[model samples]
Target: MPDWATFAGFAGVVLVLLLLLAHASKSAVSGGTPIRGGVDRPQPGSVDPAVAEVHASLTNRVRATGRGTDPTHATQPQLSTLALLANVAVSQGAFGLLLLAGGWFTEIPPSAFGVTAPVLSASTLGVGVVLGGVLYAANEVGASVGERLGIGADEGLREALAPDSPAGWAVLLFLVLPIIAGFEELLFRGVLIGVFAAGFGVSPWLLAVGSSLAFALGHGAQGPAGVVVTGVLGFVLAAAFVLTGSLFVVVVAHYLVNALEFVVHEGMDVDWG
Candidate 1:
């Protein structure tokens, strides 16, 4: 039998960790300018000679989106892209280990958490890619809607997290993003909603609501509008999880959404804001 008490304890711990992470993210955003190759661009209503000189050098090659930094107003030390990526890797790795421990203690099979052996069929690959494309399109629309509603949705966090070099992009997309997608889908969809609903004999849809809220809250770094839009996105992904019963599908789809966001916005400098 599943260890209900252990599961409850595990879930509580996960919730606390997620909230702490979210708060830390918000705090991180409140201070330092996004480190764009150590170049501190001019912020609105203020300019520093050093920053202007650096900004001037890059003006011809890269368009400044006027998002992250005001060197004169910066209240914290700049966090390097490498350090930020390392922190993400360590944190998500720790979360994955915690989930494994929880599953072991709770006597929950991997399959119960939707970690089934992935199918290698072309159709499965097509489904995940197509689903990911649709979700990315939806996400853009949601961001637009948030803008129209005067939500002041900020992409600064995304800008801050963006990698600087081609090698960095490879790591971010292939390594970091995959870890994020896998861990998030497994924790939010597989365990929180799937295992809990199945074990407690409750409605998955109801659990989806709860999980989506947590998912949204976990993205607090994105600002107010992001929380709302992400909540909706979480529900859609949850629904996909419940209907398909495949973690692979959601992980692939999630990775694609994130990867495409970085590629289109940061890489191509689309300035969709």
Candidate 2:
């Protein structure tokens, strides 16, 4: 029942606020430097041998622990993959919940909400079961496949899916993530699509495709392949929104996907790598 304009306005405000808050938090944390005084400080003219030794010891310890080092040089690829997966789960979970609530209250369905829903739930699942399985099988067929070769595919699938968190983190999730998610869906899927479709006097499909592509491009940090995958997924989600003319379904589907991913990952020891 909610029009695209309404959704867009709401989403835009929330997105701006979330970005601002995140930036502020980051700045606050990064603004200060740790101070080690007294014993660590050297006297004028002469360096204290004890202080130098202590400093060297501390430096060595930090290096050994892999802290205070360049991430590119020091990071373990497998562990990095796992961490990325975890982060994806968290972000998607937060975003999906926000969309769900917004859609529910606004009386929108999946068709209106955007591609984030059906793509992740129905379409992506089917694709994964088919294409993902094929890829995995091919890897097993002795093609010099390494561990976590399925990581890229799995990561793509998981991004479409949503995630859950411990109950303890629920409050924080509700406060921050939902608002941001709601805003993004409203702006990108709802308003952008609506305006473009109207202005160009084009079919909904065209508008959806255009908007989704734009959405994918916004994630340039993810690289070309990732962008292509996301763009395709975006188109699917947009189609769902158009078909149903509602955001509610999209939101619910998004939430379910994320929640399921979290539950699965938490319960299973499937090596992310």
Candidate 3:
């Protein structure tokens, strides 16, 4: 296994590259040809409705064929295989930094919370049950949200926690999620906290409070109350990540928090009356 330093460096590089590639891809897509010629211009003396319709149809067809509507066509630029590889390399490189930072700083003891299982099977089973319950509750909450939105209530719940898609589901659950969790922890909790703390040179508690609030604001989609809760959670999670130097802990904790909220809202039959 690579050292923590190596992982952090790699993550940082990948993150930078992803940002660059996205920008470049967008630029290339926007640089296509404009539509100022042929049927689009329309004949000067043609007043006939049928003739105008024919011209309009031909103009649309031409545009669909990857020519003229705007000088720049809507079709995305076709990147070469090598370019695609380079883009991936850059993105993955940035992510490496976070992994390295997390690994270098955090330490996980061989035993979790000072408990060790006599049998591997028992440990695995316990983890599975906990994870499953959390996921179930998260799905329920997601379903409720979907119902309110008038979308696919049942499937949306499942899909909300599914991450990206079928082809990458296993990859996401096993690899991508952990990486994201680790990187996010490092960026939001580690770097952000360090920057603010250094700048303020105030009490650590105050630093945590301010940084956590900033973190919550970063997640603007969660609404005001949600943002406030997230901000508090951010402080705790950040401290944990910094203290332990293990992204795995943050990932598990995050999953647990999401699960807990879902269970509280959906599993508990609370009476509004």
Prediction 1 global C-alpha lDDT? 0.67
All candidates in order of lDDT, best leading: 1, 2, 3
Off by over 4 Å in 3: 1-166, 194-202, 239-248, 255-273
Task: Give the Å shift of residue 250 in candidate 3.
Answer: 2.7
Candidate of highest TM-score:
1
- Candidate 1, pairs of clashing residues: none
lDDT by residue for model 2 over 171-245, one digit each (tens)? 323432343334445555665564435433568787787777666654332334435555665575566667655
Candidate 3 residue lDDT tens string, 29-88: 222223333223211111111112222333344456766544333222331222222333
User: lDDT values of the candidates?
Assistant: 0.67, 0.41, 0.39
Better of 2 and 3 by TM-score: 2
Which stretches of candidate 2 lie above 4 Å from their native place?
1-177, 198-200, 271-273
Residues 1-273, candidate 1: write the lDDT tens digits.
788568867977986876775565454443334444445422211001111122222232223444234443222223345445555666776787798788888898777776667643565567678899998999888777767886645554456556777777877777777887877888889888778877778798998999999888776656667777778888988988888777777888888988888899889999666
